[model samples]
Target: MIDAIKTFLVKIKDQGHVLPLIHQADIQVNLHCDQQIIQLNIKNGGILFLQNLDGQQVKYEISGSPTAMKQLFEGTERLRVLEQQGQLKASTPLRTTLLLESIFFLTKAQNS
Candidate 1:
């Protein structure tokens, strides 16, 4: 899953759209699925995926149940809608939240 996500991000980045959406901000974000957390660290126009928290500071964290997470990853349910309905919890400023949402939405692997 992590390798797939890395590939997805790389593909998205190579397509030339992801970086502009980020607008050159270095950020660390987390997506929590059940008891697992996947960290996305964006720095110097590159992205890294980490499966452990390791106490690193996270700029944003979005969490949901495993089913809800599947929905998000599959694009069956949008993050904004889930967040609005309290199906998912997020910690970050609205701008950052939106950024994270867009990033996730764009990098979702097909048939994932």
Candidate 2:
């Protein structure tokens, strides 16, 4: 499923019309696990920091644009809403905090 999602995102980005969405954005996804923060060097400088709280693991995936990513962390209840709305699906206590660190990264990073 991850592979499928990646392929789809890549295709969407390759389309000239959609590419403009993040022409100046970059993203980095940092997975804080194993007692360390794993940093991913996004090619376009886009960064996504995902901190999954212990005891929770998601079954489905929650996806959005860079702007939407930053907004999801406004409060704790918002996370719950995402799950309930089928945006984020997890069986454990997975808490996520998203941060936008650069303007060169976009969905292109993950999609590519």
Candidate 3:
């Protein structure tokens, strides 16, 4: 699962359209799937995936079961929809939530 997440982020990083957005933004996210936690640091025009939080301040924490996470990573589910269905939970401001949704949508489009 962590490998999949890393690969997904690598794809996003390589995307020309997404690169500009990523370069201009600094975001930190903690993804919790079941008992596993993966921290995503998006800053300085690069993305880093870490298994340990290392006391970094997190801007958002998104959590769900492994099944829910798999659905999301597979582009079979949207973050908003999963949250609405109680399959996932995200702690973030509205703006951040929208940003994440957009990122996921863009990734899905790329896969298509």
Candidate 4:
């Protein structure tokens, strides 16, 4: 799952617009799915996944069931919709939400 997230982030970073958007972002985000918790360190226009949750202070938090998380990453579900349905909750600032929205735009599925 962590590998999938890393791939997602890397794919987002490789997109044309994301580099400028995340150029100077230094943020730590904690994602909780099922019983697993991991910290994603964003810096230098890239993300690093840290599995150790020992003493990290996460600036943003998103928690949900594993299935919901998979749906989100697969672009089958939006975070806002999941939150509205009580399947997911996120503790994030407005700026972080905007940043993530932009990043996730790269991963959203296209309708043909």
lDDT digits (tens) for residues 1-112 of candidate 2:
2332344345444555444544554433442322443333334423233343454443333454333333332222344455466554333324222222112133333322
Which ranges in model 3 have alpha carbons more than 4 Å from their true place? 54-59, 109-112
lDDT of 3 by residue, 19-69 (tens): 665676688889998677888777877777788666676768999888777
Per-residue lDDT of 15-67 in model 4, one digit per residue for the tens? 66666877898877788987889886778877677886787776699898887
Better structure of 2 and 4 per lDDT? 4
Cα lDDT of model 1 by residue, 32-93, tens digit: 87677898777776777787668776768888776666556544567788888888888878
Residues forming the 10-long window of minimal summed lDDT in candidate 2: 95-104
The alpha-carbon lDDT assigned to residue 1 of candidate 4 equals 59
Backbone clashes in each candidate structure, one number apiece?
0, 23, 0, 0
lDDT of each: 0.71, 0.36, 0.75, 0.72
True-structure lDDT of candidate 4 = 0.72
TM-score of 2: 0.31
Candidate 1 segments whose C-alpha is farther than 4 A from its true place? 1-7, 74-76
lDDT at position 81, candidate 1: 81
Candidates 1 and 2, the one with greater TM-score: 1
Worst 10 residues of 3 by lDDT: 103-112
Ranked candidates, highest TM-score first: 3, 4, 1, 2
